[model samples]
Target chain A: MKGSLSDSTKRVMDIKNRKWLIAGGVVGLFLLASKLLQAVELTLPRVPLADGVDVAIEWATINLAPFFDGIKLVVIKLLVAITAFFDWVPWIVWVVAVGGAAFRWLGIRTAVFFLAGLLTIVSVGLWDHAMSTIALVSTSMVLILVTGIPIGIMASRNDRFESALRPVLDAMQTMPSFVYLIPVIFLLGSGKVPAVLATMIYATPPAIRLTNLALRQVSPEIKEAARSFGATPFQMLFKVELPLAVATIMAGVNQSLMMAISMVVIASLIGAGGLGNDVLFAMSRVRVGDGFEAGLAILVLAIVVDRSTQALGQRASKETRTE
Target chain B: MAQEGAPKLSVRGLWKVFGHESTGGIVPDEIANKSKEDMREDDGAVLALKDVSFDVNEGETFVVMGLSGSGKSTLVRTLVRLIEPSYGQIIVDGDDILQYSEKELVDFRRRKTSMVFQHFGLLPHRSVLENAAWGLEVQNIPKAKRLQIARETLDLVGLSGWEDYRPGALSGGMQQRVGLARAIAADADILLMDEPFSGLDPLIRRDMQGELIRLQEHLHKTLIFITHDLAEALKLGTHIAIMRDGVVIQIGTGEEILEAPADDYVAEFVQDVRRTTVVTVRTIMDQPDLKLRQSTTPAVAMREMGQAGVVSAFVCDEEDHYLGMVSFNGAAEAKQRGDATIADAITVDEYPTLPADTSVESALPVVLEHHNEGALAVTDEEGVLVGTLLPSSVVGAMAQEAQDATDHREASAASLEASHADDQEEADGDGDSEAVDPREGMEVS
Candidate 1:
């Protein structure tokens, strides 16, 4: 009986070996066939996918000219207003306000870190560029929030919508950030509006994904308890689900801010003026010192924004958490 | 719309089959008729609740008791339509809730029923007061009024000072108190508690059980409680339904189930229950062997006691209000001393009197302290003498229960053996063989 078991196993091994032999034979036959056909050049006719995309973009540019102009005008006005506001405020006042907020929510150490980071930007003679970059990132974040949060909420509620959204988010995150510039420049033209529009496309996925994940992660018992109490769907979402998920959603917002900051240099390639413009100018001329200065200022901004948003997320969670 | 004397909540022919189909889908007759195990194994479906029906009277605590997977939880959830049943009627105050629209169902839940979860399903983000007010909050009550009501309910549940604290800060027992306060603040007529204390420590669980009993004393709400603990079921339930394999095996009071179980399964289920804690004196009390009137002389009481072959006698007034126990020897001593009446002979202060409704466990100490007299007076709520209880009698009743259970089990096994013999004969018949006479081959053992 022992030998019988081993014999059956041996038979199984023989079958596996035969299967591999057959696979190798098929591969060899394909290779031999290809060698035999080498005399004739065989090629597939290319699909006109690139041409089709170009035609679609051309059609949208011509037919949706008014719609694109309306969006561009709104973006220009918002950018001008925000840039003017930053110009109007003294650098010290901006620093003090941010530093005071950091002190209040995060503590003295974080406050000192924020003050040092801001003063470094001013000391390096990149204060104007830094302010402009802040303005652009702020505007992009506003657009992202307005669009991303609602989409996230809808995805959380509907399974089919969530499934459909998953692949689109995957594509948005995984595709090269540079690719978004072409479509925006083609539609909205080359300026701050296109830059802002490009940043919106690149940075919005995290906000939608994190918000959906947070809402979906709320405990089933809590949801059932809410429902058993006869809460209308609206009440359940507002009173129970959103309140619990606010911390994680704030985390999504933080991710969006970081993504917007990272997009600043990329945004400058399309003639959007900011710290990104300084860095891009230095790269074209090969001025290492100027590029390093601009890069340093961007780094300081990213760190301060990241830490501040993180602190905000932490504060939200603390407010909801039991002591 | 409530009809005259309609039950507060009535569930009829409720069926919940999971993994069968989507909502409002009918289970095929072939699938429905198969046993739960077979359906799960062969059809990739679960019979969560099968043909379950029960009525909860107003102010009665109806306990659904089962081990895990017996579908008691599913049954309770179906009552509120939290888990929609495949087929059922849930009539609440004479209106079928199964037929309600979404709005009407929400209205019914807000006004009528509130559930307490075993896991204390409190909003961790909300303070205790806010959590308690949640049911009302969803109903859109004003904040001030709801908070006031919540504060009062917290006080009722002994959590007054902890109103502002979050649920996570509290211990398991205190958290469940918050759960209770939440349900109470709803002021719903029907409170559904799904194994509410099953997650607590044993000591804390006992305290919570006592707390619920205390609340129910004043609240008198219609409670449908689910529990796997038999002791908890017997202690809390006014009427209990025992479920197994998604089917109810029996429904009766604790004493009725203890005394004459409907089937062998119930008999076996109740075998481990300690009768001394569950059986009340009312169930085990007997008519006194001898009784003496206060006006009767000691000589007359002694003669009555001797004639009745009892060592002790209960003395009562002309209206049968219990006086005290008068021992035969004491009466004899009084007669020899030429006392005027049996009043002096009656040992009133030494013997302990028990209320007829008190459990034997509660009366055990007093019974033991006065076991010399061998009997104690049992009286109704109004102090009218009803019957007598003996310490020996309690032990005898408990012993009799154990004997009866054993006898019942033996009888059941014998019957099972007889049925198996019949089955064997049928199998033998399939082979075209002569059917052996069952009695001749049956072993006596």
Candidate 2:
């Protein structure tokens, strides 16, 4: 191996050209194939996929749509209930809740930053939209954890299942956020329900991925020690593995919340009303000022959510480590 | 009664072959006599242990001492089924542990035996108290009660003040103590300690060894310690099994090994051991010669001393209980001064007495300090004269061990050199008189 790749110049040149070679080969083959063909159909091969999806989604909408509607009703009701509670909460209470939690978990500086950010969001007259966004993100986050953790745990214990889920999860995350809106809109047409559903599809992957990683990352030595103590598999999972993996799982949750909020702005394309809607509307009309306000509000929400959850994870891991 | 009857742990025909999948009803015949390297090359299997068997008596520290890859670790782990044996019977309390179901194995691990890991495998997220209480918690004991027991066990391990601290906050030795505290907290009858002190520095390792021995005195649990340190095995073990190349080379007390090593391998391994510290006074001591009854006259004492060609006689009671030493000069002076019995003339606590259980290393300085005086009296706990350890005897034992080891090494070294010379001469003279190694080359010339 060393003899074959001895010269540093040759190795670096090989790597540098490798990327161009792949791109050039692909482009050259396509052009060559196209030129050689007598009658070329340049219409992107749809494979009747759109119509197929349309009919399947239509059937699901007509037959199974009621079940999803029931689920949507419960979800929206829960979201609305939480939204009402937050709406009833004076803006000062949000300040205290965010600031107080930040104070203990992070520090006085983060708490002060949280307070100022909340004040700014309120001053910009986006308070109601921010509250609505918070409600949607919180609901999606809770729903993601409720479903993601068990799936993650099950996948973690089964190699074949996790392997199968890996590429599917990659597609869920990498596929355009707008792509989710199509099928979602087909099932639950043009509403907050479809929007939240799209945001959930975008956000759920991180929770499951991180939960699986956290469970796997738990020190094998501790697991063996737990076993040597005659801990039942159930007791070992709950008492040893879960507690040790808590910090990592919390990190997963923080990422999920961030994903949900970011996806919510894209989610607004399907008639979701929130600060995300403001951004969406501003983007359509090119209203720079309105877009700035809604975008800034989202930033403030991100900072508050991201910092608190991150600080909570750091605190959990630190308390276990330090004097 | 258990100690006298069935051994605490009895292993028979135990074998652990790593990276080898044996599917047939018979073990490959090559493994029966071939070297580990040969098996690894031909069969892609490592014979980690080969037909190992040993018994650990109840309440005794059974040490499995060996160099690395010698299967001592494998043997100890098999006792707990931490590493499954390929084929064997491990009997604990007359029940074959190999036949235990998963549930029964858990029960056995739960109630019968506990292990102290070499790496101090305490839960990093848990407090010292919680880590110690972990085993008890698995037993479904209530939180408060388990914590109480854990706290007491921590106190026993000298970590009482750090109960609330996490394992990461403690030093290596302290963390190791917590591992010990965890095992003892479970209150198991047997402890399988897997080189638990090997990771510590030499000083800390010695301290931990002393701590373990001190704990062993009160606990009296059956302990199987795995170590490469022969001195440690000698210091701690009531009986030791020395292993080499996955085979038990010898099984004996430290003194027994020093007195009579079973083979050259055992001799070579124990050659570097400091026999003074490794051999107890009980093994080195001879039956006391200058003995006289306490009521014997001073003239008679002087005569006994004269007969033994010593200056003193150890006076004992009628039951041969050690009273004190009566010096010939003192007794004769007492007789001149009209003293009646040797009891009155006897010197109390003369010339540094030692218990029979004390190692010669410990008794050396005391005996050498009073070398001009008669040999040190070796007594039992009941204050009876068991034997005497002379300075000459200690020196002789040390010298004899050194001589034997040096002579063996030289003899082997010379024989090897002689064979090489003969081979060189043969190759130069006839070019084919010596048998050619098939592994070296095919052509004899």
- Candidate 2: chain B TM-score against the reference chain B: 0.80
lDDT of 1 at B33: 78
| Quality of model 2 by C-alpha lDDT | 0.81
Q: For candidate 1, lDDT tens digit of each residue in B1-445?
A: 8787888998887788887643433345775678878977886888888877888899999999876678888888888889888876888999988888899999999999999998788999989999999999998999999999999999999999999888989998899999999999999999999989877766667778778888999999999999876677888889999998788989999888877888876765566565666778888888988778888898888888888888888888899999888888988898899998998887788777788877766666678787876778899988889998988887787677568657766675566446445543432223221122211211111
Off by over 4 Å in 2: A1-70, A103-109, B1-4, B19-46, B282-354, B365-391, B401-445
Give the clashing residue pairs of candidate 1, or none: none
DockQ of every model listed? 0.52, 0.35
Worst 10 residues of 1 chain B by lDDT: B436-445
Q: Model 2 chain B, poorest ten-residue lDDT window?
A: B436-445
- Please, what are the lDDT tens digits per residue for candidate 1 over residues A120-164? 889988999899999999889888999999999999999999999
Highest TM-score: give the candidate number. 1
Q: What DockQ would you assign to candidate 1?
A: 0.52
Candidate 2 per-residue lDDT, tens place, A1-323, comes to 77776787788899989989999999999999888984865566558878897898889988997898887898788788888887899988878888898888788898888888899998989998899888888878878889899888988789999999999899989999876688777777787777777877889898899889989988876787778878887998898888888888888988889899888788777877889899988999999999998999999999888887887898778754423
- Window of ten residues with lowest summed lDDT in model 2 chain A: A314-323
CAPRI band of model 2? acceptable
Candidate 1 yields a Cα-based lDDT of: 0.85
